[model samples]
Target: MNTVQEAKRYLDNAREILREKAHKEEGYYLDTKYVKMAGHTAYVGVLVALDGLLGKKGKGRKGVDWYNQQLSGLDKRPLRSFVGAYDTLHLSMSYDGNPLASVAAAGLAEAETIIKWVESRTVEA
Candidate 1:
């Protein structure tokens, strides 16, 4: 599939995972391990979305540092939100197991926004 298609797939998959697994249900008990898994899955989707954006720009697949550098040069607001999402969702929640629900929610929202922005810029051939 093309980059835009790939990005949309990742975003859709992420949304499904978040809705079915990551999000906590009211008055329902969720396992910590499952929560952690959900966080990791969500973060992978974010990375895939970034990869799609960069690939569309002919940047090839690169690491997160490259993504950070590109974002820093391209736009400040999304860059800030991307960094925040990386810190809280990728590092704190995915790795450290200390993600505040509100913070994770916000980070996921930011990721969704960034993915949409990237999609808007995609020029399908």
Candidate 2:
């Protein structure tokens, strides 16, 4: 729960950055990517909390495997798909060559969606 609170703070900061970037005509694009990643990280934090709330955090494999297992049961297809897409984008952008502008934009959108989902789920959790 404390970890969730901290993650929520970070998520709030990411949203603030995104709101600022949205106001800019041509903002710092990479910062937008960072915001997306930050948002995803926050989502992960929320998942951990929710899993604990639901008593499913340690029921499966550890780490991302456990995360994926929980994600597999979600009823929200769009959110699940966006999370999968962002997972791919995060790996690509972190380890491979630079991502295209469109990829970054897509990642940002996915991150934003995930953040919104986290916000709603956290309340329910």
User: TM-scores of the models, in the given order?
Assistant: 0.71, 0.50
Question: Tens-digit lDDT track for model 1 on 36-101?
Answer: 555565666666766766654454666667878988887787788778778766776667655356
The per-prediction CA RMSD against the true structure, in angstroms, equals: 3.8, 5.3
lDDT of every predicted structure (CA atoms)? 0.64, 0.50
Candidate 1 weakest ten by summed lDDT = 27-36
**Which candidate achieves the best TM-score against the true structure?**
1
Candidate with maximal lDDT: 1
For model 2, how many clashes?
0
lDDT of 2 by residue, 71-97 (tens): 667755544754554464445433332
lDDT of 1 at 20: 73
Instruction: Name the TM-score of candidate 1.
Output: 0.71
RMSD of 2: 5.3
Clashes of each: 0, 0
